[model samples]
Target: MSIITTERLCKYFKGKKALDNLNLEIPKGIIFGYLGPNGAGKTTTIRVLLNLAKPTGGTAYILGEDIRKSRNYLRKVGFLPDVPNFYNFFTAREFLSFIADITDIENPKKRIEETLELVGLRNEKSRIGTYSRGMKQRLGLAQALLSDPELLILDEPTSSLDPQGRKEVLDLIYSLKSTKTVFFSTHILSDVERICDRIGILKEGRLLLEDSIENIKKRYWKRRILIEVDDLEKFLERIKESLKPNSVEVKNSSVVIEVLDIQYTLKEIPKIVVQDGLLLEKLEILEPSLEDIFLEVTSGA
Candidate 1:
């Protein structure tokens, strides 16, 4: 089941198109990474989906209810913006208690205790003012999950944290996948690679690609072979004419080449090396990374 759907959803700001005819669907019970470089309308899309900003064209549905027509979906979602605010002077338990009272949650004490424990802040008694940035982020997550909303919307959740803090927050998000559908939006490729099952790449307010991480990588997979030889100069001259590869570069001891035909290159390189009387030191296939895929698709393809 789709937890979120957008059909030709668009948002314009002061004669600029922030989102242009975006069509997206996020399935239930998975971490959906909304990836893009800066000014790619990631935040704009989130705002429209949350109904925080009205779209200039088209519409969206969250939790199966049309966002334009019903507000019932809002309560089913929890949001954590890039920068989360807190009552600096309030204790973790105190602040959550206050939120619970305002929201009329039953058995606030038990729920608050469980959430704090889940976020690794159960025993923490320090006032929020005394907390570190990481601690504050944990508290913010505790607040967001206190309601136990079905879908969690996070914007750059770890962009501002130190290495340790980023790990802590990411671990927390990864742990919630079975219980909540996480809509994770960020430009940090490594983080997305770590926890996201699926990703949608956006550029200039248009979604360029959306698929499972493995499938996307496979579809864009180009063979990159690292070949090291005794005669670098001679092999370079011969291979260009014979292999006709997409690209070839010398990196330290190895010459990395993206081959057009893996079978041909693998079979032909040995013969060329023998003909050129060059020593074949090493020949290995290099794996494609998410960064490589992101750059390739966003740049043109």
Candidate 2:
């Protein structure tokens, strides 16, 4: 069953459509990536799903229950916003204990200790003010997990962190895939590529594509063949007339050809090169990266 579902979900602000006719189904136990550029209505969608902002049109459901109907479902959901605030005066343990109490968690002390350990803050006795940005981010995650939520919705979780910090947080997020459904929304393409099982790309308030990472790669695979030859200009001219590939470009000491049919191109290109008596040093097909697909789809290029 889908852990989250939305149908024609929309939100507007001052005559601007933040979310437009969005339809999505996020299955349980998968790390789902919600990707888009800034102002692409990513945060707006999250707000609507949490009922923090009322949808101007359509509806959203969490765990098969409509968010507008009741807020009870929130108990089972954990959220880590892009920017999380904390009381600088409070220590890590103190802050977690406070959150536990507010949430009416049973045995708040034990839960706080467990959560501290889970986020690698077990030995932390310093006030939040003394914690590094990365530590604070981890603490934010610990607070979100305090209630043992089934669904964890994270917005730009690694936004401003250093490479080391980003790796640390991403590792923590990866560890949760076995136990929780993660809805990770970010513009970081590499992070999505690394951890997301499925992804949905949003552009100008609309969902342009949604599918498993593997499926997307296959579906949008660009058959680009890169050929390195002894004479770049000669090979470029020969292929332009003989091969008639979809597109051709001269790059430094090599020629790049984009073909519609990989099988045909692979068979035909070599034969043409051999016939021309030109030295073919290296030839390989180039796989399209997620960033390549994202730019093409979002920019409509």
Candidate 3:
């Protein structure tokens, strides 16, 4: 089931369009990566979904309930905004306890301790004012999940973390995916690639593409064959004769070929390589990454 959806969603600021006629469906119980460059409207879309901000035109739904009408639905969602503010005077444990109290949660001491450990900040019992930016972000995440929410909306979830801190948070977020739905928005493509089951690429306030990781790679990116042939001239000639025009390029005694059908190319490549008496030093298919797809879609080049 689709836990989050937006239909022709549009959000305008004064006269500027931040989100334009956007349509998206995020499946339940899966990590949906919302990707875009800065000012691409990723945060705007998220805000609308949470009902933190109203949309100018169109509608949004979360957990099958209209976002505008379902104020109580917020209880089922955990939100970590790009920048999370807190009472710095409060210690880590105290801050968590405050949230638990406001949410009317029972037995919050145990829950607070559990969440603190879950974020790998169990040892930091000092005031939050002394914590690092990364620690604050982790604390924000801990608070978001304190309710044991069914849906998590995270914006730049790892933006403030060091490598180790980021990894710890990511591991925690991934662990939660088994039981909760996550909508992770970030400009960091690598993070999305690591944890996202499906991704939507938004650019200039519009969703340019939305698809599974596998489907995006298959549709816009393909595996390439890199071959090292013994006789450069002969190998080049044979490839030209046997392969489609402009498909093969010879570079430094290595031939890189772009083929539409990987299986057919694999079958035919060995024959051509052998006939040309190539060394076969390295023959492998290399697929494109999410970064590659992101550049292609956003640049319009």
Candidate 4:
């Protein structure tokens, strides 16, 4: 079942369209990366889903409930904004206790303790004002998860942290894949590749593409092959005749070939290598990064 679904959901500001007929469906138990460049109305989409702002055109459904008709879905959603606000004076435990009280969470004490520990903030005794940005972010996540919501909507959860901090948060997020449907919205390509199972690319408020990462790669795979061998010159000259590449170039010790048909080229390359008695070091397709595919779809180039 889809935890989040949108049907031509749109939003506008002034005379400009922030979102234009964006239809998206995020299935359950996957980390769905909502990818877009800056000023692509990512946050605007979140706001409307959360009922912070109303849609100008079409509507959305969260956890099978039409957002236009129901506010009940809000209770099952956990939100951690780009920059989470906290009471500066409250310590980690104190702050979470406050949140639990307001949300009326059952067995608040046990839940708070479990959440703090889960986010690695259990032993922290310093007030929120004394925490680093990474710590603060984790704390924000703790609060979000305190309710043990079925769906999580995170906005750029690791954009500002150092490498270690980012890793900590990412590992924590990846661990939750079995239990929660994560709508992780971000511009960070690498993080999405690292943790997301599927991605939805949005540009100018319109969803350009939405699919599993593996499927998208196949759909937009760049037709290029990378081959490294000890005998680069002989391998290159022989492979050209055998594979009939559209174009080929020698970069350092590897032959980068552009192929009209990648699968056919792949099979033919190995045959040529063995026939010529050339030692094959590495031979593989040059995989396209998410950023590459993102630009390809969004720019229409």
Candidate RMSDs in Å, in order, are 2.3, 2.0, 1.8, 1.9
lDDT of each: 0.90, 0.89, 0.87, 0.91
Q: Which scores better on TM-score, 2 or 3?
A: 3
Tens-place lDDT per residue, model 3, 1-301, is 8998889999999989999999999998999999999999999998898887999999988888888777777889999989887899998888889889988778998999899988878889798989888888998999999999999999999987888888888888899889999999999898999898999999879999999999999887655778876676777677667766347767787878887677877888789877666676778786888998999989982
Candidate 3 RMSD computed on C-alpha atoms after optimal superposition onto the true structure:
1.8
Worst 10-residue lDDT window for candidate 4 reads 236-245
Q: Identify the runs in model 1 with alpha carbons over 4 angstroms from their true place.
A: 270-281
Q: After superposition, how far is residue 102 of candidate 1 from its true place, in Å?
A: 3.3
Give the CA lDDT, 0 to 100, for residue 281 in model 2.
90
**Pick by lDDT: 1 or 4, better one:** 4
Best prediction by TM-score: 3
Model 3: worst 10 consecutive residues (lDDT sum): 239-248
The 10-residue segment of model 2 with minimum total lDDT is 234-243
lDDT of 1: 0.90
Question: What tens-digit string does per-residue lDDT give for candidate 4 at 1-301?
Answer: 8888999998989979999998998899999999999989899999999999999999899999999999998888999989888999999999999989978899999999999999899999999999988899999899989999999999999998899989999999999999999999999999999999999998888888889999999888769899998898888778777778888888998888898987788788888878888888997778888989988888992
Model 2: per-residue Cα lDDT over 1-301, one tens digit each: 8999998998989989999999999999999999999989899999898889999898889987998788988988999988877999999988988888878888888988888888899999999998887888899899999998999999899997899888888888999999999999999999999899999999879999999989999888878899998877777787778668898877888878897788987887778778878788999988789999898889992
Instruction: Show model 3 residue runs off by greater than 4 Å.
Output: 230-233, 250-253
How well is each residue in 148-245 modelled by candidate 1, as lDDT tens digits? 89999998888888998888889989999899999999999999999999999999899999999989888877799999998898999999998888
Residue clash pairs of candidate 3: 230-278
